[model samples]
Structures are given as C-alpha cells and as structure tokens.
Target chain A: MASIVWLAPAVTPATEAGDDPLLPPFGAELIVDFDLALSPYSEGSDDQQEVFRAFALGLHAGRRWHRWGVGLAVEGTLWRTLDGRGEDDWFGALHTGLEGSVLSAGGRIRTRVGGGLALLLEGTALDSAGGAGFYVDLRPAGLRWALDDAVVGFDPLTLFMTLPDAGGIPLVDVQYRLCIYAEFGR
Target chain B: MSARTYPLLLAALGLMTLPAAAHGYSLQTAVSDSCHERITVSSLDVLLDLVDDVSGFEVPDDPLLRQLLGRLQFPGTEDASLQVRFVMFSIIIGVRSPDTDGHSTFNLAALRRLHADPAPRGQYAHALRGPGDDGIAGDLAAVDGTIAAILDEVQTGASLSAGGVIADKPAYLDHYGVVDVPVALFAWHVGRALHALQDAHAHMIWDAEVEHIVGVLNYIDAVEGRLEDADGLAHSDALDDCHRDDVAPLVEAATRRTRALTLAIVEAARTRDGAALRAGLAPCVDDATDRDACGWIVYNPPCRAAIRAGDTDAVEAVCCDDANDFCGSPYAAIARQEAVGPYLGCATAPAGQSGGWAWGLGLLGLAWLGRRRRFAAPTALALLALARPAVAAEADEAADAADAPPRLSVVVEGHGSALDDRVDAAILSPAFGYGVRAGWQTGRWRFGLHVDRDYWVSVEYGARVDGGVLDVAAFAEGLFFDDYVRVAFALGTSTLMFDTELHSTGNTGVFSEIRPLGLRFPLGERLWLVLDPFTTTVVMPAIELDDRLPSLRKVQHRTIVGIEGGFL
Candidate 1:
C-alpha cells in the first residue's frame, strides 16, 4: 500500500495545472537579452543593408494570472552598432507590456506574444539632441521553455520602430533575442 | 500650453542646447588646440633660431634637442622621433590628461569623457587677478620649479651616463611605466612649463595703460560661489576664448612669452646655466610693481568710494587711468588691508548638467504619489525630516522596537562586482564598491537614499577610475519559508559620476536591482546580518565604459553582504 501510494500521481492545484510552470503568480525577474538584427535600418545613415546588434539587460516586475501576465520593465540597451559600422550607442527604455501564452504544448512549451511602448530616455535617440522619443517594441512571436525556476525564451520576431517627429523618417529594425529570465515570488 | 508661451518654451529649449563656457581653454571648440599648438610651434622656431646662433649647440647632432624639435614639429605623425604633440595635447597631460584611449586617438568616447571632468581651477595656470596677484606669481614659480626638476633630472642623467650622453637613454618613467629610452621626458617637462607660461598671457588682461598684463579672472573663487571676490567674472566664462577678436592681443602676448621661455630653456641647456633658466621664466611671472599698482587701482579708498556710489566713470578715471599714480602709500595700505588668503582646493561640483533630470524625475514621482493618495504627505515630510541630523537620530532610536518592524533602517555594505562582462581581466582588475543606504520602512516596503563609490584599477597601466552613484530608491520585499528567505525589488533613479585618469564624466539614469534571494539572521535587538546572494543591477544609459577596454555587456552582478540596523 505504501509503495502504491508513493507511485501514484500527486494532486496538482488547478491554477498550477493551467499556469505556465516557470513563472510565478507574482514575481520579479532579471532578464539578460541578446538581440540580433534581421532588417537593420537607421534614419541617421544612408545604408540600410548593414546589421545591427544590441544587448539589453533589464528588470521586470510583474504578476501572472494563469497563462496571461503583465509587467513593467526598465531596460538598458547597449547597441554595438546602429548601422553595422562599429560605433557604440546607448539607450534606456521603460516598457509596459502584456504577455500571454497563445498555445501550450504539454504545458512545457508555450507560444507567446508580448509588446509595449518603449519610452526612450530624453536626448538619447532624438535627432534634435534633447527631444523626447519612443519606440514600439513588440515580441510578435516567441517560444519559451519552462523550467523549475527559470524560463529560457527565444523571441524570433521582435520589432522596434521609432515614432519619429515631424519630417523625420521612421527607423525600423527587426531583431531576434535569446532571453534568460530568473523569476521569484508566489 | 498657451500660444504666448510657445516662444518662451522654444527659447528655453534653445538655451538648453547652448554650450556652457568651459574651464581653461575650450578644447572642444579647438581653441586650445589652435592656440597652444600655434604658440608651441612658433616657440620651437625661436628655439631653432637660438640654437643656430649658439656656437657649441649642435641641433642635428644632439639627439635630445633634435628629438624635441622633431617631435614638436611633427606630432601624431608616423615618424616617431619622441613624439610630443601640441602643448595642450602632450604637456597638458601633466596638468589634466585628455580623455584618450592612452593612444593619441580623440574619438567620441574621449569627447564624452571630457564633458565629465573639467580642468581643476587655479591649477594649470588659471590664476587669480586683482588684489591676489600672488596666485599668478606662485603658479609661475611652480612652473619654474617643474623646469628646475627637469633640468636636475637631465643633469643627474648626464652624470650617471658613461660620457654625459643622457640623450637616447632611459631616464624617467613614462605614463605607462614602460622603459623606453627616448628624449621625450625632457621635451615633455619643457612643454609642460611652457603651457603655464603661455596660459599666463591668455588668462590675464593685458593692461594697455600700464603696458603689462594684469587682472586675471579667478576661477576658484568664481566656482566657490564667490563671484564678487572673483572680480565679477569667472575664469573661461566666454572671456578666455583664444579665437575671439578681442582676445587677439592676449594671444599674441602668449605667443611672445612662449617664444621667450622656449629660447631661454634651449639657451640654458646649451650653456648649462641655471641662472639663464630663471631669467627666461621672468617674462612669464608677474611684476611686483605692476601688480601692487593694479591692486591699488581696484582697492584704494577713492576707487572703493566711487564703486560704492555707482560712479563707474569717476572710478575708471581716478583708479584705472594710465597716468594715475596711486602706486605709493595707497598701494601699500590697500595691500595690507586686502591680504590674500591661502589657496583653497578645486571645486567639488560636477562640471555640467548632470543629476538634474534624476532629481526632477524623483520629485515628479513624489508629486504623482501625492496625487494618488494622502499618505504621501507624511512620507514627503519624513524625507524632509531625514535631512536633519537630530531628526534622523530620533527616527533611528524609535525604529528599534522589538514588537514591530523598524520604521527606520540603515544598511552599510561593501560590494564587489562578482561578474563583469565589460572589463578585460588582462588589463583591468575587478571593481569593488562600498555603499550606505538609509531610509524609512513601512510594512513590507522600504524607501531610502543610497550613495555608493566604486573603484577600478588598471593592472596594466596603473591608472585608477573612481565612480560615484547617488540614488533614491523604493524597495518591495516579501518573506517566505518561515521568514528566512527574502526577495526584494529595488527601482531608483541613479546619478552616476566617474572620475577617470582623463577627466570626470557622469550620467543620470534609471537603475533597477532585483535581489532574487537573501538570507537574514538576527544579531541583536536592532541589528541583523543580511546576505544578498544574487543582486543584479541594470543602470540605464549605462555608466561610462572604461576607454582602455573594448565595449561589451553592460550588466554587472554583485553579491552584497551587509549589517542592517533599525533605529529609533
């Protein structure tokens, strides 16, 4: 009887069964993200065919209800190069976004989409020097591997498009990121 | 928001874009580059002429002289004959090194670094004028002393050498401490002394009536919030621009003095006469009679009376007239009355517009909170009360209650970066930091102010980089597993200041720290030992990267261990 009891499946909470395994109901995460540009474009440069790369390190504080989550993230991105030419540029962005798993494969693999307005720091990306600007940062599609305490995700279709001022061309770039997230909370 | 306010808003925005007057000569405006290089090149020409006239002096044969001449002539060129560039570029390194990659490359990174650290006032020959002409005299003496040190080193090197051939011998330590046998050291010191001599001309007003340079604007006094004491003008405040048309006469005088000093140094080296060197420095130093006379013109009773009565024309006629003879008893009396004080150190103020945006955002956050709830009123009051030492002491004592959590807490910790992706281990050692945080705690939330200083040392070049971060943050924490494990999220606005070998640079940015795991152990009634196993800090617009290293990842992870104590 003891052996049978030990072998039998344990009862799982209804919320735990439906929720993403790695993320807590309420948690904070430190995210280290590496981004590779797909369609690199900059309004400041004449060439649009070059590659752009950036590393974004951020902190996300959020709460999750089942498969859907909302969070505020402050990300500092160090761009290796904006126009494939090796010049360093830095930007600090504050983002508010919603993330929800659209498809769940065995509750281990989840397809997610997240997006938000990334408000850029003033005088950072603005052509007029001190002017304020923002970018529409979107994770159109992503795949996440749920672990016991961490979530490793790959965002294949991340897009960043600047909301330009008058007479300014919209700068757009498509990037892919490998995100490592360490989460804590209930 | 109003139509009438649009122009004012636009004007304010334009004013924000206007560049502030820089310290010393404006290096960014290329004024220093142009003026210092021009004066130096012309001085070299004079030295060459003097050398040609001297019988025993061999310009081409003497490796030291030839090297000095060649390096000054073709600086930053491929032909490295002891490559010393312009006085601003080479010798100015002794006063304030330009933010370079240790190489002569001046890029955007170097320019940004310059924005961080301005030249220290009164150093580098930016002397005070008027009643305290002794400052300029002292600065010239220091330059003379440096010249003497160089000559002494040269003589010592000659004595130590086999046949008095000190040239092409390893005599002194270079910036990197590499033992390179070059004639750069002698030229470097000469150029360094000449820098001060030339600045004496640019910094002082060339009094046409007295036919002598007088009235140097005091940068130290100006920066110390003593503008009246500084003669109502700050050093380098739109006044010391070498390219200005009004500054043409001063620049010419600088050029002449520079030539005179250079010629004297060459002559001294040729004849090996210390007296000749002293004679050469005389042209650069302040004249005691002229200085005394000028002091009386500004400080005499009649001039002071006119100044007090707002009779500027009368004061100018009586005190500043060319033929005025107030250089007698009044000069002596005023000199005794207006005795100058000991020189104060450089200003600790940050050079440019930094920390303002962070403070603005913090205030805005408070306002937003106030609008959201009435509870913010007491919080704001508490923050204000914390500024007073006595109130803070009381708050600390009150927070030591055993029944409830502390209302006020303080934490002091020494933290070192456990992981750094940006630093090259071969070049630079890991950075270590110490910080203090103090604030009020209510329930599960803590709001506080923290100040941290991080230091980095270059193992290869022996250069030191110091950084300061001042932050106002709010932390939310939760305890689980019998109150043993704690997790906290900290969000703040951080103003980061960096003092590098080149200059000081700083930026205001938002920073977030997520302590995923922390262990707390009680030590006493009010004290606890807290160990944060994992703390990841991400500062926006990232802290200025070390120029000596290649740019890489910005995130730095630190393990912080500290003692937290609750106070009344």
Candidate 2:
C-alpha cells in the first residue's frame, strides 16, 4: 500500500495567505523568476564572456496526469544587463512555448525536470532592435518545496537557450529561475 | 501597444478562458467536478471501468478529461483505441468551449450546421468571432441542440423499454459512435452544458481588475464582503453598472438550474421518453432566468459600449486608478507596497525613484526564537556522545536502547563575492562581500539564519556616502538527489546606511532571496564544499521613507557564490 499524506490540503500560508486548499489537477501558475546567465562565448564581447540578469514573469496553465504534466507558458523577461559589454541598453523578451514536466515527490519536497520549445515573441540583447525567433530549452534541475500555503521552486540549470533574436549571432545562454506558485481548485 | 489595450486584452482573455484566468475564481473546477460527479454516481464510472479493462480505452484520472469523456460512447472494438476515442470526445466538447483567444472552437453558424448534421469533420471550423453586440442567437442553441441530438440518439435502442437506466442492454457496445449509452451520454452533454453555464457566470462577475493577481485578491475580497466598495466594475467605464455582490446567488441559481436539468435528462433517458427529453431541455430554452443568466448578453452590452466609445484615455485612467486601488488595498499594503509603488507613481509621489523595505527580520527573528526553544535535540546529542564511553561499560543498558534516533547536525557556511553598488553612485567602489550561514539539520531539511555583510574593499569617500551593508535572513534548506544538491530561500532584512544631507538613515529593508543552484562536493567527513553558483535577492524597505526624497527604492538583484559544511 502506498501511504500518502495530503500536506497543505487546505492552506499553507508560509509566504502569502489566501491560496486555495484543493490541489487541482489542472492549474494556472503565475511565476516571477530571476534569471542570471553567464555566456562564456558571445558575439561582440572583447573579454569572451558575458553576464546577463533578467526578471522573468510568466503565466502558465496546464493539466497534470499523475507525475507528467504538459502546458503552455508565456514569459515576459526584462533584461537588466544584456551582452554585458557596457552597452547599457536593456532589452525584453516574450517567450511563448509548450512546457512539459515530470515531477516526483517525497515528504515535503518535490523534484521536477522539464523542457520544451519556445517561440521568442520578442528579441535578444545583441539586436538592439527587437525581433522574434525560435529556441529549445532544457531544465534538467527543478525543485519545489511546500512553503506555508504556496509552492516555491526554481529551475537552476536551463540550458541551450537559443532564442536567436538577431541573424549571425551565435549565442548560448543558461538560465536560473525562482518561482512561487499556488494551486487553485481540484 | 497602449496601456488601455492591455487591460482590455486581459478582460477579454479572463472572460474567455476561465481556466487560465489569473483572477482567483474557484468556479472552473467546481462546475467541472459537479458535472463529473453527476455521471459517476449514475453508474458511468462502473461502465468506464469495464470498458477500460476490456477494450483498453483507459485514460488517466483527469478532471477536465473525465468531464468531457463522461458522455462518450465507448467503442468495444480494437479499431477504436483509447487515444482515438479521447480525441473524438475532445472534438465534441472543445468545439463549443472557449479557447485562449476568447473565441469558441467553432462559430455559431458552423456549430448550427454541425448540430444539424452530427459528424466529426465540421467540429474543426475555427471560430474567429465571439458573441456580438447582442450576443449570438445560435451559439447556445446549437450547443443545446447538439447535446439533445446526441442524448436522443443514445437512448435509441431496438425498442423503447423501461428498467434501471438502460442496464438491460448497451446500445453503444456494437456501434463505433459517441451516442449509445444513457449514463455516459448524459454525463457528457450535461457536463458540456454546465461548463457553458459556468463560463457565462465567469464573465458576469469577473470585473476589469480580475485580469491579474492583485486584481483577483480585490475581487475575492469584494465578493466575501471584506471590502465595502463596489466591485472593480465601478471603476470601469465599460462595466460600472454591472457591479454587484450577488455573485453567490447568481452562481447558486445557475448551478441549481443546470443540476436539475441534468437529473431530468437522466430520468428521461432512462425511460427512453423523447418528450421528457425535450421537456428537460425546456429550462435551458424557455426558462427566462436560466437563459438570461447563462448568456454572455450580461457582458456583451457594456463591453460593446466600451468598444464603441473608443475612449482609450478613459480606459487607461480606470486601469491606472484600479492599479492604485489594488496597491492601496489593505491586504496589499504590506509586502507588496514596494513592488506596486512604482506603478502608482502616476497617481501619488513622483515617477523618478521610490524605495522602501519590508521588515522580514522580525518574522525571521520569531522563527529563530521558536526553534531555540523547541529543539533540545542538539543538547541531547552532545550528552549522548559524552555518555557513549560510560554506556559502553554497561552492555545490557546500551543494548536496551539500541534503536535510538539519528542525531541533529549543525551546519555553518561562509563565502565571499564581488558587488556593484549602483544605487549609491561611487560610494562603494570595488565592493566585496562575505556571507555566513548557520543552521541545524536532521536528514534532508535544515533551518538556519544567514548573514551577509558587504563593504568597500577599496573605498574612495570623495563626497560619496560609504557605509557597509548588513543583511540578516532566515531560510529553510532541503537536500535532495541523495544529498548531492540543495535548494533554499531566505527571507530577512537588509540594513544599509542611507546618508543624505538632512539625516544619516541606517534603514533596515525586507528581502526574499533564493539560492536555486547548490551542488555539494565532499572534501572530508562532515565537511563539504557547497558551491551555490546562482543566488538572487529581492530587496525592499521594511518601513516607508519620505517619497519626497530621491527615488532610492529600486529592485536589487545580485549573484554570489558560497561554501558550506556540517558538524554534529
């Protein structure tokens, strides 16, 4: 027999209160993530290195069947530093994509690994002029903890972020994110 | 795009796709469940279980899927796989439902044609338009007609006979179609119809502000009578007249009507009575209350009025004022003030700069104080270790208590990083910072206090104020993947010296920081090099400073690396 404990079946307001108690199979998540990327190789960097920081706020809704879940997410990323070449020009990206996750949990912690394809609705830092393109992302590491009434987690290693905003710019960016989510209904 | 367009887009999207709507409406799953339960209790689950086991048409336990498939006639043949029937079921239900763009899968015209000719091909005509100025006449009609048609065909057997809700024979067992069983078919049509009704309710109550998270809180508060003001509709030039707190009654009315219609349909299907079926559906058509309540006309009028006015300025003003109200709201007045303060710049205070902090230290302090009193495990562990030699002398005594619990371990960590103090211009040039973390852990979970102090390694105090920043945070850390990785978030206060011409303010600000990526490389027993490569901090002041001063309130982000170890 598999013994299951319905942790926070009603409310766990560690961070913020008024979250729905029932862990509905289908949910909408509002995530505010801080993305820090270090590109060892870049287009026009003299030092052969670029450090970028961005604040990504995304809205995603999906249905979960057991451990596997699939959904669509639209992320609006505001880049604080792009290219890191003293350009001082900030950029923004709107990434709309299909995201899939496989999650497993033990005790109060749940670990998830997710990846998907994203359409860059906006542009990259190098373009200076914003544009859109396609990219593939892989998050090998993601973890969620039951924090009070809300669930908080982050995808640490988001690799192969090739939004390809501008032509002839071969760049690879790795992203890290911190997210807080609340489940609405069952 | 104009700011006005954003709110309108949100409003439209919120009304269309209630499932994905950000506002905290709990009706989506409620309606979905009520529809599913109606069939599950009517022997639909038993039939599904048998079909799943025999014909391999099994699907996962999903609420929305269950509702959609509840009315499906399971094909008892190898040709119709689970995927095939599932897709067919989705096509039948999805065509009438709202999509992400707030449009139905099929338009009223196409749905009417599909209802006239029951087939799967016509279910794919993408509806580009939603309800018009007066609402679509044929949209709900076609849905009802199709539902009735399917239920009528499902009840059609070799001969119309009465007994135990069609348990005598299974009409769908031989045919590869959707309309065969009374239980399954009734569940499906009723579920779909109920979803439509609930969707209609979503549009009526979801005011302008229900577009985002803060707006959702306001809507919930308003509905619960916590807020005395009229709903967000009052602020909207479009929906001001529709503002009311009668959402409960409206929803209750709709729910009762839909449930009654479902039960009546089930009874008619059981007896194979065609007239009773039509009579059951009469409420959906003739009953003025249900019809009026379950139509988008409630929103279309005001929405069209706003659309015709084309008053972008008015829309923006309302949206901005709503944003202001959300910021000034009692619930959001605490942790969210710093975040919303900048957006409220158009209303209050200048748009230049705004800075404030949250006193997360008090919360952290309380937790630490509580932890100190609750956990005597550390002291007990020390005593146990000291008494090990004496206990070893008495073998019998030691053997009696052999099943002892694991000892709690104390962890301490410290690291250094480089900082770019952009806010204090040239005040802390070439800054370097160090952080320390101390906690007690038993197994995978750890609770601790983290302190980080940033000072100018090389300072040139040339008219620029230079002072060290001290940050104190409390966090919960969890080790996973066989203890190879750890993740943690810290909530605390950042005390920084704000040197202005008038006063020297060493203010404490609130912050929530997370180290999402931490990998442990063990160098020796009980010692590990815990490399946290990526750490981000969200900083704000605990107390509000004078907004008349320069806008010092800006969201701060930093990246730091640290090393940690554990010693019991």
Candidate 3:
C-alpha cells in the first residue's frame, strides 16, 4: 500500500518499513566539497589560514549484513590552495572501514570511518614532500535520494606523516580530501 | 508413677499450668478459660507417661523446649488457643497409624501458607475455615487425623520409609519426628499452631487502628469465653464506633464449636473409637461461608490496582506486605518510571500537530513538480493528491517504527598559536599566526584538516620587509571511554613562503601536530561545542645556498574551540 503525502517530493513505498533487513547491497556515491585549514605552527609570528577547493571520486566494493557493511575504497583527490599562490596537487588514498545506513525511508543517511594511506603525485611545484602517507577518513553525511539506487556523500580525510628536517622556519602542513564514493556491489 | 514424678511428667509434656489472672491475655489465659488447668495438664501427663510405659523411651527435656513452650503463649488471642491447638495436637498424633502415611497427612506448604500468608481462595484458606466450607469437607478434612497419626508414630518409635514421594517423605515429619518424637518437637508444633491461630483470631481487625480493639476483645474472650456476655471492658465508650456485633458472633461460634469438637475427638482417641472420632470431628467440616474465617477476603487497594494493571512485581510486593510483617520484594514501579518513559516514548506529540507535516510536504512536493525540472508534473500531481491524507498517518507510522544508526557530525575550529625561536631569528622578527581546523566525527573517531600561517615584518635598511610561513596538517582523533574528550595526532606537509624586497622563496617540507586535549559539550540533540588545543612542528626541506630564501624549522602551540552539528 502506498500513500501520498502532500509535501513529499515522491511517494515512498509503504513496504519500506519492514524490508530494511532485505535491501540490496552494492551501492555507489559521489561528493564535492570545500575544505578550510588552519596551521597554528609556523617559523615566525604569522598564523596561517588557507582554504582549498577540492574534489574526489572514489569506487567502493563491500558486503552488507543486516544493518551494517565493511568495504574498501580507492579514491583520487585534486586540491588547489586559494592563498593567491600558484600551487595545486593531486593524490590518492585507500580506505576501508565500517559503514551503515541510518534513518528510514527517503531520509537514509550513511556514515563511514576508517584509516588508510595516501600518496601525493603531481601539480604546482612547492617542494619534494611526497611519500606513502598514512591517514584517517570520516564521512558524516551520506544521503540517498528518493527512488534512487545511488548515494551522495562527503568526508574529511586527514594524512599523518613525519618529514625530513631542512632548516630554520617551522612548517605546519595540513591537507583535507573531500570525495564522493559510488557503491558498486551486490 | 510416684506423685513427685507426676509434676515432672507435666513439665516435660509442656503442659504445666500457673495461676490465671482475670482478664488475662495469652495462650495460657485462653487455655485456662476453656479447660480446667488441672485436667488439661494432668491429661498431657498421663499421655506422655503412657508413651514412656509402652515404648520404653525417656521424654526429651531441655531449656530450648521450655522456651518454645513459652513462645507459643500468644498474648491477647484467645479464639485460636484451645480449639486450634487441640486440632493440631490430634493431627500430629493421628499420622503414626499404619493405615495412612504421616507424610501424606502433613501438608507443610499448606500449613505454612495458612500461618504466614493466607490467600483468599486457596487450600490454605479452606483448611483454616472453621466449618461449612468446601475446603474443610474436602482437602482439609483428613488433616487432623493425619497429624495425630504422625505424632502417634513419633512416640511409638515406628520407623518410616526413607526417600519416597513427597507425601511419603515430608520434611517436618522427618525433622520433628526423629527418634521417638522429642518433647521439643511437640512444643515447636504447638508454637506454630498458636502463631497461625492468633492471626485468625484477629482477622477482623484488618486496619492497624483497630488492632488494640481486637486484643481487648481477645482478652474478653479469654475471661468471659464469649463477647455476647457484656463486661466492663466490652461496654466501654471507646469501642462505640466499632461494629462489634458483626464480629462477635463469628468469633464466638468458631471458638465454642471448635473447642467442643476438639474435646470430643480427644475423648474418642482416648477410647480408641473410630466411629466416635468420625462423629466428633463432623463440626470441623466447613461449609461455603466458613472460607472467610481466614480474614483475607479483602485485599489492599493499591495491591489490587497493581494486579489489575498487570504489574506483577508491584502486586507481589504489596500483597506480601499485607500478608506478612516483612514484604518479600521492595520493587517500587514509580521509581523506574522516568528512566523507562523516554525509551518507550511515553510522551509523543499529539495527533493534530503531527498530521500537519503531511500538508507541508504535499505543498513542497507540488512546487517541485510544478517546476517541471526534477520530476514529471503528472506523477507529482498524483502524489500530491494522494499524499494529503496518506502522509499524515504514514509519516507518523514511519517515525514511530524507524530505527536510526549513529549520526555523523562536522566540526570547524579556529585558534591562535606562536612559532618557536629557531624560525624567529631567521625571519628577523617574531612569528605568530592563527590556525583553523575542519573535521568530521564518526562514532568515536574524528578526522580533519588544519592549516596555519605565520607573518613577520621587519625594517631592513630603513625599508619595510615582510615575510610569512604556512603549515598544513591532517589529524586523526580517538576519544577515550566514549567520553567527550579526544586526543589525536596529525601528519601532513607545510610550506614556508617568504618574500622580502631582496628575495622570496617557498620551501615546502614535512609538518606534524599532537592534539592532546579535545573537550566536547552537547548543545542540543544534534549540536556540540568542542574545545581542542595542540602543538605542531614544521620541518623545512633542504635548500641550496644560491637560493635567496630563509631556512626554518620550528614548533608551535595552539588551541581552538568550536561547534559541531549534523543530522541523522
């Protein structure tokens, strides 16, 4: 039985309530975001405040059980500094962790958190600060559109590293990756 | 036996009598009123002397047995004393006969139920019912003879079979009937009977206020034998409000008939006449109305309500309190109301207000359809038309049935920090800057990006020279004990971008930070205030001497407080 609500954008299936345990697995998502960064440690008295424009596309494959799922994601990220400086870079990270669907009906929100490693590749030349870097990722908001099989979401990805010491000025390197993952599994 | 041994025999049988005061209250007083003290004491003396003569056994005599005899003297409860004790004594002796098993006759559970917690409609009540009740005529009819047989067997040293069905192996029989039934066992059983009987005597005084009134009536019964005959105590104005007429007849009938009935059975037992024993015990057979004799016809109102409400724990507690001095369980349902209310959603918004959401959603759905952008108008119009009534009920149902997973939140923080001395001297000025952070929280962990920029300005050769440093780092955080406090470590890259009138350079290097403290405060259902403070270290990459850029490595400290909010 399906009932129409006046303000509802689409008629949701009345059967969705008891069928959550039987929903199909294997899903995908895409996301676009802007990241704001603050570096408190510098060589001198000047504090650093910078915003970066970034986008990421990730492919996820995982198995879903009753209410939750564990999966792996390989993502590509592109970021550019908005400090009026000519600098940009591209990198990739691998993430695997637990993700689960929450809320019922058309308001399904998915969340994921896990740790992995990242590598920086090309773009605006700043310095040779590239390597295999470890990082953690968290996706707080992932929502599926009504009557759609796909999901859209965004996450804040953090990289952890120790660099070779050069000279006097202190540097605080902060990087955030914003990506949308499209699920493709059964 | 010699005359001197007669007194000793009476003492060992626990039937020694003392002088009775007028209007005296106790089992002693009650027994003294109904039976001639010399006759009753001498009767027990003769019975025990015969047991010793026939069985060649010494009657057990100890201070503990004397103390038990004293405790059986229930003060101010005359109605239960003579008749109730006689019936119990007869039953205790009758069980020893080979015709019937003593264990079958002794229903200890039934006895305990009657004595301590009499239920209104049960075998216990029926057994205590005086006469004309089905229970007396049916299940309880054999109890007296059974107990008397048991007592007989105990005195005769008739060994009972061990390890059989419940009726063949009663605990009380084995315990008290051990080794030619000790005199102490008889005393203990008498005490138990007095305990149950005394409660029956005061059954009419259900409320605490009239308890003393019942005691006075019992005292009157002890001295006067019946309340029908007025005494100074009974005629007192203090009892004017008490409808004594209603209760007096019942007590009088039960007491008088039970005493007569008991004496007849004992006399028949003495003569060993099966026919007379059956005829003498006829009055003990209860008719229907006699079931109320146990005085548990009415239940406490709260206890009744709790039972009707299906609160078994409350009912158990309340009923136990009403039946006994110590309530069995102290589970108060009211105490747990608050904690259970939220989980069961006892407080839901009213129907009218909740139904409004449907109309709102319908209008929005219509507007979206009217735009002809995302969805076709025909499908949207159909949805809008059907949604008005359906949405109201369906939305409520969905909300009620939905189960949600843990939510995710984003936190944005900004704070100031100072760079260490290594880079201050190279920059020719002290460097200080502000760092900002943006992160998302998932369950117990937080992941975020942070960046800081430091600026230095100095006068070189009378001209203004300005320099800046920037650092970027990413942190992964974990909370302890699922508490609001979090600690995290960061790793990323930093670039020291410097430019003076003489030279400018961007030296990119490694940077890291340690987040030692993060305190969070929940603002509402989905918002939280977070305070995080940390230290960061920025390492610069190697530079050529020909490059006109300053090299720097430094550590900085910073703190940030912010808010996090999200949706489920």
Q: Point to the candidate with the largest lDDT.
A: 1
- Residue-wise C-alpha lDDT for candidate 3, range B115-191, written one tens digit per residue: 21212222122122222222112112223322233234222322211111011111111111111122223222322
**Model 3, residue B376: C-alpha shift (Å):** 47
Q: Which of candidates 2 and 3 is the stronger one according to lDDT?
A: 2
Give per-residue lDDT, candidate 3, residue B455: 52
List ranges where model 2 is wrong by over 4 Å.
A1-140, A144-186, B1-432, B455-468, B497-505, B545-560
Could you tell me every candidate's TM-score relative to the true structure? 0.38, 0.27, 0.21
DockQ of 1: 0.01
The candidate that achieves the highest TM-score relative to the unseen native structure:
1
Arranged by TM-score, best first:
1, 2, 3
For candidate 2, the lDDT comes to: 0.34
**Fraction of the reference Cα-Cα interface contacts (below 8 Å) that each candidate reproduces:** 0.00, 0.01, 0.04
Interface RMSD for each predicted structure: 21.1, 23.8, 34.6
